[model samples]
Target: MLDIKFIMENSEIVKAACKNKNEQDNVDKIIDLNRMRKIYTAERDELRRQLNEISAEIGEIAKKGGDISSIKVKAKEISEQVKSVEEELSIVEKELDRLVLTVPNIPDSSVPVGFSEDDNKTIRIIGEPQKFDFVPKNHIQLNEKLHLFELERAAKITGSFFPLFTGKGAKLVRSLVNFMLDIHTADGKYYEIFPPFLVNRDSMLGTAQLPKLEEDMYRVEQEDYFLIPTGEVPMTNLYRGEKLSEDDLPIYYCGYSACFRREAGSYGKDTKGLMRLHQFDKVELVKIVHPDNSYDELEGLLHDAEKILDLLGIHYRVRVLCTGDLTFASAKTYDIEIWAPGTEKWLEVSSVSNLTDFQARRMNTRFRSSKDNKLHYVHTLNGSGVAIPRLIISLLETYQNSDGAIEIPEILQDYFGAEKIE
Candidate 1:
């Protein structure tokens, strides 16, 4: 959540920031609500002072044992007025909070002004697209012919966008998860955490996934917990409400978890395969760092994710996310897209974002300065160190051979215990 003081002091700047991000916010109404809440508070305090004075006078009349009824009645009327003012104050406060939540995080100055993914500029291309002589098959066809997947049973059990992996498909999924984790944890010391599948509402808000993406999530109504949409949700909340010392400036965490999303609004897109799913496996990298170092951490995190596609020998590209394409918590974001030759498109495999104090403020997660002992909000960041299923899709499509074999990348050959998956 944004600080009200910041909003009050920088209303115009905030409105301009929202305009650049192509997001709509009722800035005028937000300011008006703040004004109303402040006015209500002042009046309520004044009324309470009057009520206290009247009660004191009533007490004196009672002590004197003469004509206390009039004083008592006056005190009672003041109490009712105070109650009415208090109720109005409560309404104004709620409206102010709702308005504040509607205002999104401002884009960093470096963020380019754009309204859609089409306008995103490529920062650089990591590796060349794979050269293939034969016609490459998509993951769906390859998985089916090789007896690697069973969607029929998956549909019966759940519904569309769910696939059951068997034989090679299961191994492929496991291998992908293991491979991604190993790379992210190599020397970087990303503490691996296997988080719970379900988390409370506060967990969702910490990562800026709630309030807006609430509809896309699966909530257990009675328990008031929601199935995690991604490892990002639980991983970031690990340090929720925590205060770290300066020496703990950076906390790197990598979590493996099963993510569930309703795909609630997406009706017909990527329904045939793992491009989008109700449930998928992922490894996410989350960091809590000093504000000055967060942008650099963003690059490091992106490279950590890019290293996977590079190691897999899969062709991919990295794009600096335009402001409009950024997540609610991110000040700046970079998405890693892998080339899926069969589909003739780039599949986004990960998004590395730098959220400077936006999440920390909401979570009340802070860090104390080593030099001055001053507490400050830490900048938070997270990325799919890589998601399993989509990367699998890219790998299968890029490595497919004319003989219906899929050559495993050299780095993962030993992990999967064979050079080729056929």
Candidate 2:
């Protein structure tokens, strides 16, 4: 949520952001509603003031044993007028609030102005794509001989696009989760949290997922709860509606969760094995930091996410998302795509974003400065330390031997326990 004052002052910039993000422009409506709200509020306040004076006059007349009925009637009329203005004010405020939520966050100055992912700027590419003497098989083709996962059975058990990892596949998923948690929590750089997978509407709204992406989420209609789309949702909402001390700035948290999404708008896209799923596992990283260092924290956050791929010895590249490709709540975002030799494509495995104060404002999360004793919205950032499905796809394809065996990376060997899945 942007400050109404800021929107009023910077309507043009906000409008541009809406255009860039491909969101509907509601700045004009919001401005008009806010103006009406101010007018009604002032009218209500002035009427109440006049009513108070009339009541005082009535009291004096009563004390003097004089007629007070006329003054009392005037006071009643003013009181009724106050109620009318209050109702108008409430209506305006409600509409203003709804429109405000529809407005996308302003893109940071550094973000490139582009209309699609093709226009994204590549920051750097790390490592070289693995070379294979034998023709590499895609994850699905390898799965046939290796018997890692059963997509047909998974579809039967729980609709399409849901994975049912069997035997070594199951172990690999668990090993990856544990490995990521260990890396992120090592040296206490990030606090590990295991949060609830189901969240309420406010939790969704706090993370800026409700108004825009609600259709893509799984909802428990009876309880009005939503299945979390990522660990970032639950992890970031931990401090919702709370104030923290400045000393607690730069709070880091990492957690693994099973994310669910309906992919409502993603129909007709690649639904190949592990390409897209209704449910997936991911280790998410979130940070709450002082505004001054938020961008710097974003860099560190991206590095932390990249560290996972680096340790796994995967070839990946980082691309800074253009404004049009940015998420609703993110001021800036960097997507990490891993090269999948079998798929002959780069798959996005993580997105590190600096949301600035966009989410903090919605969550009403603020920190008190030690120097000034003033509360200010803290900037929020989140990233996929890495999502499992695509990573698994790349791993199986990249490390596959000619004999159809998968050699686990050295760092993950202990966790995976003799991981040559033959």
Question: Using lDDT as the measure, which candidate wins?
Answer: 2
Which residue ranges in model 2 land beyond 4 Å of their true spot? 52-72
lDDT of 1 by residue, 1-422 (tens): 67888888998878887876766777888888888888989988998999888877777877888788766777788889889988998988888777777778888888887889987879888777777888888888887678777778888999877768888789888888888888878896798889999999998888888788899999999999999998988888888998888888789999788889998879887766778888888889998888888889988888888888778888888899888887777789998888888777788888889888888888999888877789999999999978888888888888889887888889998788888987
Q: Work out candidate 2's RMSD over C-alphas.
A: 2.0
The global C-alpha lDDT for each of the candidates, from Candidate 1 onward, is 0.85, 0.94
The reply for model 1, stretches above 4 Å from the true place, is 46-81
Ten residues in sequence with the least summed lDDT for candidate 1? 17-26
- Clashing residue pairs found in predicted model 2: none
What lDDT is reached at residue 377 by model 1?
A: 90
